[model samples]
Target: MVKTKIAVLVSGGGTNLQALLDAQREGVLTDGEIVLVISSNDSAYALTRAAQAGVPAVVCSRKALGSQAAFEAAISQALSDHGVELLVLAGFMSILSADFTSRWPRRILNVHPSLIPAFCGKGFYGLKVHQAALDYGVKVTGATVHFVNEVPDGGEILLQKAVEIQPGDTPETLQRRVMEQAEWKLLPQATQMISEEIRREKDQ
Candidate 1:
């Protein structure tokens, strides 16, 4: 069986990266193997996680790049150089433009911290999402993994898992719950699905 070469993009603590790594080690993630991790922040703990995993990681600081185009180009160059066949935006903060996204089409994946169509879009991310959901008084919130497209969090949905909003749940608590119950489980599963798809196509 062929394993799809994967690269994870991150900008913060690599809890999601750790999940995928744990899954891979546990044999739950069989169809893909993470080969690289890219971070927008050089100081991000995600880079350390990558190092501990023995996965190559590169830093492309947007502040240093001086522009979104330059930043994305640097990232693209790194990805291309590494021969990354599958891209996973685990917690990558920078928004990619249509030009960059178009090259990968459905080959890229992102896990948004919301159920999608709700608490999702350009301005919604991280704790802001959970805050909005709690502010809106929604009883349910979860996570969504989707194919990357030009629109932020507007891509085709691959998988979603619902986590209930508990009584008096703060945004931080909800975010943690959503990550553990939804994001952690869903990402690896989606990775498996996409990886299997890619492998099947490759083996053909």
Candidate 2:
């Protein structure tokens, strides 16, 4: 089996990145290979996770660039240089430029903390989604792994795993639960789907 080359983009503690690495090392995620780990924030713990795993990690900052386009261009070039076939947005916080999204099209994937199309839009991220869920008394909330389009959080859905919103669950509790679910299943499942899609394309 040809392993798909993937680069994970991160901007914070790499819990998800570590999950992916663990899954791969354990043969739970064998269809693809993590080629490089890239971070927008130099201080991001995700970079440390990559380093400890012995994976090549690079820090590319948007602040250094004069514009978002320039930043995207640099990152795009880096991806090309690394021969990355898939872009996994592990915990990246920046909104990607349209030009960059056009360049990669459906090659990029992102995992959102909510069920999507519901608790997702501009300014929805991190603990915000969970807080909103609790405030609104929603009975359910979950994680979504989807393809990223030019617009923010407006991508075609690939997979969604729902978690029940128990009463008295704080934002932290809910977020932890959702993350645990995603950690065990989301990344590996999405990678497998991408691998299967690539195989089908090759056959055709």
Candidate 3:
């Protein structure tokens, strides 16, 4: 069987990226291969992790490119150069250009911190999500992995796993638990689902 080449886009610690690598090594995400990693921030730890894993890691900045479209053009060129068949947004912070999103469509995937359509939309990310979840006093909060659309965090539902909020849980605790869940299951499962979908489409 042919391996599905994947590119991971990240901006932070890249715990999710590490999880994908682990899954690949353990034979869980068997349908795909991580061909490259891209980080919007040059100093992003994800880049270091990707290098350690022996994958090509590129740091491209929109600030340097002058416009979002130009930045995306650079990214598009890199993805094509690396032969990336799929793109996964682990913790990528930037709002991608509409042209970029359209070019990828269902080929791009994202893992959001919340269940989405609830705690996700504009201006929601990272600790902000956790804080909002706690502030809303919702009994349950979790994660959502979805397809990428023209709008940020506005994508077709793919998978969601809810994590309960305990009575005494703070934002920090909630965030920690959520991150743990993502590392252990969500990210790998999301990637596997995308890989399987691609495999099925090809098989047909």
> Per the 3 Å backbone cut-off, how many clashing residue pairs does candidate 2 have?
0
Better of 2 and 3 by lDDT: 3
Model 1 has an lDDT value of 0.93
Ranked by lDDT, top first: 1, 3, 2
Q: Write the per-residue lDDT of candidate 1 for residues 1-204, one digit (tens) a residue.
A: 669999999999999999999999999999999999999998999999999999999999989989989999899899889888999999989898999999998899999998899989889988999999999999999999999999999899999999999999999999999999999999999999998999999999
**Candidate 3 lDDT, tens digit per residue, 47-138?**
88998999999887888788888889889899999989899998899898777788886899888889888889889998899899989999
Q: Model 1 TM-score?
A: 0.98
Better of 1 and 2 by lDDT: 1
Global lDDT for candidate 3? 0.87
The candidate maximizing TM-score is 1
Q: Model 3: runs farther than 4 Å from truth? A: none
lDDT of 2 by residue, 4-112 (tens): 8889999999888988899899987777788899899999999989989888888888897767877887788888888888888987999997777877777899999
TM-score for each of the candidates: 0.98, 0.94, 0.95
Query: What TM-score does model 3 achieve against the real structure?
Result: 0.95
